[model samples]
Target: MSEIPRLSKERMNGWAADLLVCLRFCTRVPIPALSFEKSTPEISLAASAYMVPIAGALIGAAAAVILWLATRLGLPTSLAALVTMAALVALTGALHEDGLADFADALGGATQEQRLAIMKDSRIGTFGGLALVIAFLARVMSLAVLTEQSLGLAVTVLIAAAASSRSFALLPLYLLAPARTEGLGAATTDLNERLLTITGITTLVIGLLPLFAGASLARVLGALVVSAAATYGMVVLTRRLIQGQTGDVAGAVQQVAEIATYLVFTSRL
Candidate 1:
């Protein structure tokens, strides 16, 4: 058998180290030999957390390009938006959607233990199914409206919204305790100052971009404000209801944040 390559033990600068940490948390990419000090991983996780927003922006941008192309090809605004949404789902492997579904099923269950069990079941329940459908429908409608208003603006809003939502999702991870002894939450429980700083900076930058492009500053700010509030609220509620945060809860936060961003932006228009 081929020897497994390990993660480099050599000291990595802040950005590179953070990227590695993100890969560790977001995906199963193994860098066996590489290891960072305890403090390093925590900071890296935060930095990685910020990357979620960036990833959202990239996904949004790509989707917008697609929608724009479709329109040029004579597709209706509704169809273009539908295609863009489908493309976004496929690109991310529906990771957030899965989280949302698992969260809904868990939350709707009869009891706390049942909720936790449902979240981990890996099977789709009626609640989860419904949550997925509703979320998708909402996104479709939101994007369609934006597309009809202005394709360029739609793309800008989508990119900003996606990035901002991911940043919002990290709120629970930062505030709440971990639910289980293992999994991604355990691997990334430590919330360092560096991580917080990086996320904060990224969020501010992304949130402001829409305004410079002539978007309503009030509307964009509303989205960011609501998302931040919702994120904090979810963290508080998760602590009270489930006693801690889980992957599913984090996913739920992301879904809500995304929806909040879209709603806030659409309402402005």
Candidate 2:
């Protein structure tokens, strides 16, 4: 039998290290290097999902800053929003986009067995392509609207939307059991109450900090409110489809909520 891994060292490292693990797992962004030996420990990875939103916020801020600079350099709103969205996809290696595609493909599968199998296949399908197109267009168009308003507004929307979407993405994890006995859903069952509280508060505070910094209160609230609605939709879809959650469902939640946030921000309040 394989020797059981100990959480003793993992417990010792605490939040900072866990945050690093979250960064490494969630994105292609470069981070300060952790020591070589303990970089990919299962124990650390298991707990690190709690910090997914923190990673999302950092990634969102970076992409937003890039978009702001492009506009500052006189790029048109459409062009700047385009570049920013591309950067967003690259930063996370399109992690959430791929999930959106998988879940979309699952929609056409007609059975749980077929859907799960399609999700595992590397090729994209018709539904997956359409999902990506809609998701891409929604973000770019909504962001273009915000960019026309102001760079600060654009940045706030992106940061708040991305972070809050990511925060709620973990809901499927908390509410539904894993669909599989292996892979990310199975590996990430260690989100204890204290850890959940930490991430939830971190998501809230980080998501709301820009508001105190003078972001449009109504727009920010709109984004989060719509994101919550989107998350609920995802929960219902996932529970009804698979009776539980998978990594793809979690990713779809993030992307869907993100698009919903941007949509709300672009609406007339």
Candidate 3:
């Protein structure tokens, strides 16, 4: 009995640490640095990778709360949605958006080498700018449509998309490899086998729970199908273009998957 209690306590402590590390890396949520500043950044991030879904929940909840409050105050659904979207961007520091833009610029490059070089550049090109504009518009518009239908539905979509997309974002880390061995991708792709298993379990349970409670079975299934398909397409494209994935590629995957989630639900409604 004593040993079992000790083991449970240890697990709980580790879980908190993992969550803190993920929160630090994935958001601007004002987590104390003390919880994360002592560990090896690479190893800690890899260990916390599976908790991405939980981090997503935190992020999604913030947006949902903001949207709920805004609409409660008589703001139009469209404007409330844009505010929520803006809140999300601010929370994440536009981390994934930057990835989408960089990857879009890379898409215009003629060869794998050229693609990688372009992705590294800080400047946003025409393709990058256009991609950002289209994605942002689609996200905001889709969210507005969902919110107009029902605030409950809007909250469901936002939280569900955030968690599920991040869960799927784990694909590139586990699938191909880093396109270049010198950056963030290379460091994080080395996911622990046991940790990966745990993450997979959590991803399925956490990713599906919101949908099951807040949406229909069909919607749940559709989101799974669409996000999976988009993730596969991204993997294939990255494999062909850079011969592997990168941090930017991972970010792009998250954004695409999140948007795909919104589009799927909106299309049927």
Candidate 4:
């Protein structure tokens, strides 16, 4: 009986540490120094996987608040959408954006070896520039459309997309082997299935929040299907292109999944 309480307390402490790790992994939010003294960043990442959707929701909420404030100040929907996107980029330090760019640049390479080399290069190529422009435009247009329909719709969808896309992005991390000896992919590949299940359920619940705000069930379901298909496509493409997964591939998955979800939300159907 004595040991049982101690074990429960220890489990709670581990969970708290994992939450901090998840936040630090996904956002630029500041945490206390004492938090780090008890946690190992890389090792704790997999344990904290279930909390990743929550972290993404936090990012989305921050951006959504900015969107709401800008619109309240009478900013044009388009401009407000742009500001919201800028805040998102700032919050995540453009981590996924950078990865998408690198992945795009790698697409121009003719061989696996060349592709990997291109991905490592810091320079942006024509393909990467085009990818960024097109992706940014699509996201802005989608948000602007939602804002025009209703602020509540826009906010709810944004939070849902941010949370679910990150959860879907983990599919590649789990389904494929790391492309290299060391990196984010290798570090996070060893996931706990029980935790992954928790992550998926948490994301699904958050993704369904738009329904409460009067979104059509078909629309939400369609968005989820599209996001899943998009993620699946990334998995196949990465396997064909590099024969394995990398951090950039995972980032690209998140980016595409996010856009796919937004597109479904804004569609006529």
- Which candidate achieves the best lDDT against the true structure? 4
Candidates in order, TM-scores: namely 0.83, 0.88, 0.92, 0.93
Put down candidate 4 lDDT per residue, 1-269, tens digits, no spaces: 88999778767776667767777877776777555445433445776898889888888899999999999999999999999998898888888888899999999899999998898888999998998898999999999999999899999999999999888888888898888888888988778688889998999889997897789888888898899999999999999999888888888889999999999988886
The reply for model 4, stretches above 4 Å from the true place, is 1-10, 35-43
- Per-residue error (Å), model 1, residue 29: 12
Give candidate 1's error at residue 139 in angstroms: 0.7
lDDT of each: 0.74, 0.81, 0.83, 0.87
* Candidate 4 local lDDT, residue 40: 36
Residue-wise C-alpha lDDT for candidate 1, range 1-269, written one tens digit per residue: 23333223333444456555554444333545344444354464544665665656666677778888988899888888888889877766687788889887777777778777888899999989999999998898998888887776787888887777777777787777788887656656776667677877887787776675567778778888888887887787787667777777877888888888888877845
Determine which window of 10 residues in candidate 4 has minimal summed lDDT.
35-44
Worst 10 residues of 1 by lDDT: 1-10
Residues 136-213, candidate 3, lDDT per residue (tens digit)? 999999999988887888887788788878877778877887889777688786687787777767766655654644
Off by over 4 Å in 1: 1-17, 20-47
Residue 83, model 2: lDDT of 96
After superposition on all C-alphas, the RMSD of every candidate to the true structure, in Å, is 6.4, 5.5, 2.3, 2.1
Best by TM-score: 4
